[model samples]
Target chain A: MAFKAGVITFPGSNCDRDMAVALEAVSGEKAIRIWHGDADLPDGLDFIALPGGFSYGDYLRSGAMAANSPIMRAVVAAADRGVPVLGVCNGFQVLTESGLLPGALMRNAGQTFVCRTVPLSVENASSLFTQSFAQGETVRVPVAHHDGNYFADEATLDTLEGEGRVAFRYAEPVNGSRRDIAGILSENGRVLGMMPHPERAIAPAAHPSLGGEDGKRLFESVIGSLVSA
Target chain B: MKVRILVRLKPGVLDPQGRAVHHSLEGMGFDGVDDVRIGRMIEMDVADDTTDEALNTMCEKLLANMVIEDFAIEKLDNEKAPA
Candidate 1:
């Protein structure tokens, strides 16, 4: 059977098409486009992606409004059912706002929008998303956000690290994320949230200098692992 | 009835918008400004019988993000609707 991936498009979602194209290019199956107002996700989905964009025009906080959208109820339910869910950039904000992930992405400590390619080290390669990278390996991904600073209390930070839930960390300080955390995985490792845009790395030419197809391995790892299971 | 809602960022949370405005004020020759914090005010019209609980629910559910914002509700008499 073909791997079926779904990408959600909220009203202001700008990356839904990019996410869908990337998913199809990587998985060889057309990605199902789900609308935010809908109350249900497509059936028999292999994976779900919440793409990044200015959902609800970033009102009442970046993702606060979108988190309460009608479709999010279904997304939360799917997440609970162990469906592999990936939230990128603003999607990460939505996930945290919806209580799917821990902590919050606040304004950048430097008080400016951060838009640049950042080096990230794989912290836990055991998760479904990071299996492509050797543990401690550094990969470059572009991050663009006004509120990418990750904040959580010390205890929550300790829990995430002790439980091996941190999937990626910044090799250098791009945003003031707690302990330089860049990505994280859910307790069951079925959900991953990150501020960097991995979909931008689909092509070898995507990276101007590195020119290495590092991100292709991420999609391959997830789909291949699912197929084998 | 007229209702006014004040939404504020929770303590310990950084307010970048507020800080930016503060910087702008300093640039305008306003010195000695101790601090600046930004908040939102939302005004709405409701029935006279609207209880405080209902207004609180509206704030909790939509007007404010409890994680980062706290909201207070005040009802003003109809004649006080900003002239």
Candidate 2:
């Protein structure tokens, strides 16, 4: 059977199509499109993706409104069942807002919207989402967001670091994320939330300065891990 | 009843927006201002019979994110309505 992947779309979600395209390109299967208002997800989904975008106009707070949407209840339930879930950029904000991931993405310490390709250090490559990355290796991914600064209490930070939950870290400071942390995996390591837009980097760009196949490798990693298991 | 919720970032959390506003104030030559921290105020008219639990629930569940922010609720006597 083909790999079953579902990419969720929330209102104002601009990257939903891109995410679906990336998933399909790597999985060799049509990606399912799920809406935020739907109370239930389609059954037998092998993977779930929350694409990046300013859902709800980023009102009240980034990802605050979208987290409370009906579909999120189902997403949370699905995640609890060990489904591999990946959230990128605004999707990372949504995951933190929904309590599926720890810490909150705040306004960039520079107080400006940053859009560019930045290098990230693969902190934990053994997880479901990052199996393709080698630990301590650097991969360039495009990040575009205003509220990408990640914050967590000191104790929680210790716990996350101790548990090897930090999946990715900014190789250089692009935002004000503490410890330059760019992405993290859930306690069970099935869910990943990151500020970089991997979907945007799936294709090798014409220029080396631009992103490359790192994103495709991420999706391929998920597919490879699941198919082999 | 008229309700107001003030959501502010916790003291220790970094407030980039607030810091920017403070920088702007400094640029404007406002020497009297010691510090500035921006917050949000949300006003709503709920039923007179609304309970405190319900109000807090709304803040905790949706209005304010407990992870990085704190919220305070105030109920006005209606005559002092917000202009």
Candidate 3:
């Protein structure tokens, strides 16, 4: 069968179309658009993506409200079953809020919303999302948010690093994430939550600042891994 | 019954928003302030017979993120909505 991918759109999510378009561009298949209120995901889905945006106007906290919505329960179950899940920006907040990932994204230590392409290193190139990347290679991706500073206790950070679960790390300081972490993977490396927007960088642009196609490799990696599996 | 839940960033977690406000206070010439931390207060009205477990569940499940936050539940003695 054609690659089965789903992109979920929480209310106020602006990156849903970009995510779907990127998925289709890389996978040669239309990504199923799933709504936040829907309780069930389409079955046999090989991949699921939660795109970035200010869901519920970022009420309570970034991704706090949407994490409790009905659709997330289904998403959680899917992740538990070993389906690869990718969350970006606010979606990263949602993943942490939903308990699918650890730690919390707090307000930026710079006390401002940072929006630009920043360099990130592939901390773990073996995960489903980063397999296309060479270990420790620098990649540029766009990040736009006020609450991307990642925070967790020291012990959890040690555990994540020791297990090689950190999928990406800031090559240069962008947000004040602990240990300069940019993205992380679940225990089994089936789930990834990152503050950077790979979907925004998949297509090459006239301006180098607009990002090249490094982000496409991530989706390509996901598609390639799933197809072979 | 009326309940109040106070959610705070757990100790040692950075609070940039609170720090910004502290800077503003300093800029305004307020002195001797050692630090500033911010917390959220959520008030709810529920059935009189609501159980403690249910209230705690609400906080644990949605009201607060346990990773970097802690919450305390307070039951109001009487009607204490704003005057």
Candidate 4:
């Protein structure tokens, strides 16, 4: 069975096309583009993606306005139903603002927009999102964002780490994220929120160094697992 | 009534912007500056009938991000206060 994936597009979303293309290339299935205003989602969606961009012009706060958009209600419901969801960059901020994720992404400690391919270590390989990676293995992906610094209280951080909900950790200080957290998974491991742009790195040419094809495995793993399920 | 909301980063959190500004101030030869921190002030004019609860609600909802920042609401000009 061909896997069906859905990509959500907000008004200011610039990476929606790239995300759709990456999903299509990896799964051989055309991605269903969903608008932010709609309340319903396409049926039989194996996965959902929230692409990175300055949604709602970063008004009030980054991702704060988009998190309250109409379509996000459906996205939240789908996530609660165990359908896999991936949120990248601004999408991660949206997830946090929507209360799907534990904490908020703050401005970088460097107070500068960071854009580069940084090394990330796989923290939990059991999640559907990070199953393609080996624990402690470093992978390269480009991260671009001003508010990517992840912040959570100490107790919440401890809980996330103890529950193996942490999906990825920065190999080095990339955005001043707490504990160098680069990616996080929902308690059920169905929802993933990360700052790096994996869709941008789907092609081998996206990152010349490290001869990286690591990002392709992420899409492949989800699609392959969905097909088998 | 005019309400002023001061939103500031929580203590212990790194403030690179504040640090940069501090460095610049020191370079300009300002003494006894001690330290510097950056914050934003949102001033709004609301009707006299607006209650404090309403103002707090606005601060909680959008005027501040409670995670890394703290916000204090000040009643700048009230009906009984100076014009």
TM-score of chain B of each: 0.91, 0.95, 0.93, 0.85
Q: Write the per-residue lDDT of candidate 1 for residues A1-229, one digit (tens) a residue.
A: 6898989998888888988888888778899999999998888988999999999889877888888998899999999999999999989999988889988888887788888778889899888887778998988887889888888878889999999999989999987888999988888999899998888767776437643456666787788877677
TM-score of each: 0.91, 0.98, 0.97, 0.90
Candidate 3 lDDT (Cα, 0 to 1): 0.92
Ranked by TM-score from best down, the candidates are 2, 3, 1, 4
Question: Cα deviation in Å at residue A114, candidate 4?
Answer: 1.4
lDDT of 3 by residue, A1-229 (tens): 5899999998999999999999999989999999999999998999999999999999899999999999999999999999999999989999999999999998889988999999999999998898999998999998999999999889999999999999999898887999999999999899999999999888888986896898899999999999988
Per-residue lDDT value at A132 in model 3: 95
Chain A in model 1: its TM-score?
0.96
Error of 3 at A161 (Å): 0.4
Show where candidate 2 strays beyond 4 Å.
none
- Roughly what TM-score does model 3 have, to 2 decimal places? 0.97
Query: For residue B24, what is the lDDT in candidate 2?
Result: 94
lDDT of 2 by residue, B1-83 (tens): 89999999999898888888889999999888877888999999999999999999999989998999999998988688786
lDDT of candidate 4 over A79-122, digit per residue (tens): 99998999999999989888888988988888899998899898
Computed on C-alphas against the true complex, the DockQ of each candidate is: 0.43, 0.89, 0.88, 0.53
Instruction: Rank all candidate structures by their lDDT, best first, as comma-separated numbers.
Output: 3, 2, 4, 1
Off by over 4 Å in 4: B45-51, B76-83
Cα RMSD (angstroms) for every candidate in the order listed: 2.2, 0.9, 1.1, 2.6
Q: Candidate 3: lDDT of B41? A: 98
lDDT of 2 by residue, A138-201 (tens): 9998999999999999988889999999999999989899999999999999999999998998
lDDT of 3 by residue, B1-83 (tens): 77889999998888888898999999999999999999999999889999999999999988898888899999887856533
Per candidate, native contacts kept equal 0.24, 0.88, 0.94, 0.53
What TM-score does prediction 2 earn? 0.98
